[model samples]
Target: MSVSPEAIRSALLARREIALIDVRQEALFALGHPLFAAQIPLQRIALEAPWRIPRQNTPIVVYDDGEGLAEPALHQLRALGYTQADVLEGGLAGWKAAGYELFEDVNSYSKAFGELVEHRRHTPSLPAPDVLALIEEKADIAILDARRFDEYATMSIPGGRSVPGAELVLRAPVAAPDPDTTIIVNCAGRTRSIIGTQSLINAGLPNRIFALRNGTIGWTLAGQALETGRQESVEKGEGSGHDLARERARDVAYRAGVRRIDSADLKGLIADSDRTLYRFDVRQPADFAAGHPAGFRNAPGGQLVQETDHFAPVRGARIVLVDDLGSRADMTASWLAQLGWEVLVLADAFDGPLETGDDGAPPPRGPHGRYKRPYEGTDNREAAMQAYLDWEYGLVAQLERDGTHGFFVI
Candidate 1:
């Protein structure tokens, strides 16, 4: 049976079982999407679906942005063993017409909260050009690229240190030993920059910290010069256990009005013989590559939480998380758990492992040879830059409608 926008809206509001899939490219989905809808480009469905959804018979509803794509997607899923697959009645436009909220930009809620935090805390940040000039003049600013090390090696602002996203909180103080040293966090785009800066802010570091405005994307777009390097020095820490972190995360969840579930409750739900259960290992590709649980697949934590619908389109499905360390899995799980998912953090398999670099790595840059973001649609022949900005502007309201964001200050 085809799903109507009204039905989808009701299901979302009631927090019922349903997976609303947007069979569009990542770029288009990023432009704007229903709060709970996940973006799984039609092309990657074959490769990603079984890994993400797992259940051959899960009820799956696919939609597109008024484009004639969902029909083919429905056929595709049916062929792939999704017996209950169907299409959304109106695509995204229909939902918009129904007055349901649409979120814009990638990581809408997290990015908005970042902006909110910056405004509320009056957090400091340096514009790309200013930061560039300071570097050229041998100024005091310590430019730390708060992204993955490999991303930094591809392209970076001259002299920026490679600090991976997760390590920022644990390693920032060491990066700038003196409290007086100015610290700047940056990623390929805005999310990590904001998140990295806030990580230090949350950690209660004494130094002045700021996110490099707009991150490396803004830097590259503005025609700023960049440097390439592979050498990185970042100190790593031991895993803080799930049990301890969960209790602490639970407090954070409680403050954000999120709920927690025990392993027993989760297992009982997993035992349900009729449903699909998806366990996502929301850590970096490198971490996932090293070792992960048997049933769990890799989807980075930040992106997983932000684009949950895309990852686990099967609504009401069980989602268990695995992380090598506690903060990322805990933080991401907190958001998803609050969103009314049966979320849990499985204990890390590795404790006190040999550390990786401590320097802030730059954001993933150049071409991700492994996974090209699908929705970054083929550059429109006639699309203007402003269209991109407009898409980002609308995402703020989308985050509001999604509700249960479960993010907060530390």
Candidate 2:
């Protein structure tokens, strides 16, 4: 069976639980695809289909750019028990012919949504040069890197401490104890930086907060130096500070309409076999490895928010985040809720000793089809970096035209 691009577009606009899968290699898929399409390369279908498209009866439409891979993928999916598998009538060419937009790069929708948030909220930020000058002047400023710790260690602004996204609220108070201390949050690029800065703003932090504009990319572009092998991090706080952070995060989540789920509610949700459920532990990987509730996958809160599409491919699915630290889960859930997810944070759910080891989806396929994001590595060309920033700036207009993203800022 085959599906038309118009049909797929209508389903997406209607917010139906249909999966538009790109059956090409990561490299090609990264080049262009329908905004919501998830890349599950033909070769990895058998390995990934069951886990990614959890419902055997999920309406799945596979496509490729006339690469002759879609039909094979459709067959493989059906053989693997996907009852509603079909191919795109005209493939990628057909979708484009139908005048639907094709988004470039992986996690396109999430990145686009982040851009939309920044555009709509006019999230405050400071240029890298100004930030550098502040550092040189030894201004009363605290730079918190919102990317993963390892990413921060790679190349970060000097004097910047690692405080991954969801950890910002939990750790920022300790990192900048003085309410007067200026807090600057940054990521490799704009998305996490925007989200991180806005998170603090949403949490009602007294400190003056801003995102390092364009993140490390702008810093590098401005001929500024970045520190490598940095070890500074915001350690977990104690007593009233931690409790205050937790309460603040929960309040933010509540405001965003995120639900609090107990073990009983979680069990009932799990029992609903018809719905796709994603249970993630939003703590750091090291913490997750040390101990996490069973049946939950480790997706650090920062990465989970940044890569929501990769983690939870199925739109309209329910997500329950597990975290021993209430602040992390609450903060993560708040962002997820704003991003149009039916998200819940488990409260005091884990009782016994927790399980260890990585339990998430298989490791991501290598960089074959992955776009070498300018914000990621140190060696990207200046043109590519600038071009990436330009693309992000235009995402709000694209989202408006797409008219299918259920995202809302705040």
lDDT of 2 by residue, 43-79 (tens): 8888888877777877889999988999889889888
Model 1 segments more than 4 A misplaced:
25-32, 65-67, 101-123, 133-141, 220-223, 229-233, 237-266, 272-277, 302-310, 314-318, 334-342, 348-394, 397-410
Which predicted model would earn the best TM-score? 2
The 10-residue segment of model 2 with minimum total lDDT is 362-371
- TM-score of model 1 (CA atoms): 0.74
Give the per-residue lDDT digits (tens) of candidate 1, residues 166-197: 55554565677688888988876565676667
Task: State the C-alpha lDDT per candidate.
Answer: 0.64, 0.87
Error of 2 at 167 (Å): 0.9
Model 2 residue 298 distance off true place after TM-score fit, in angstroms: 0.8
Residue 314 accuracy (lDDT) in model 2: 78
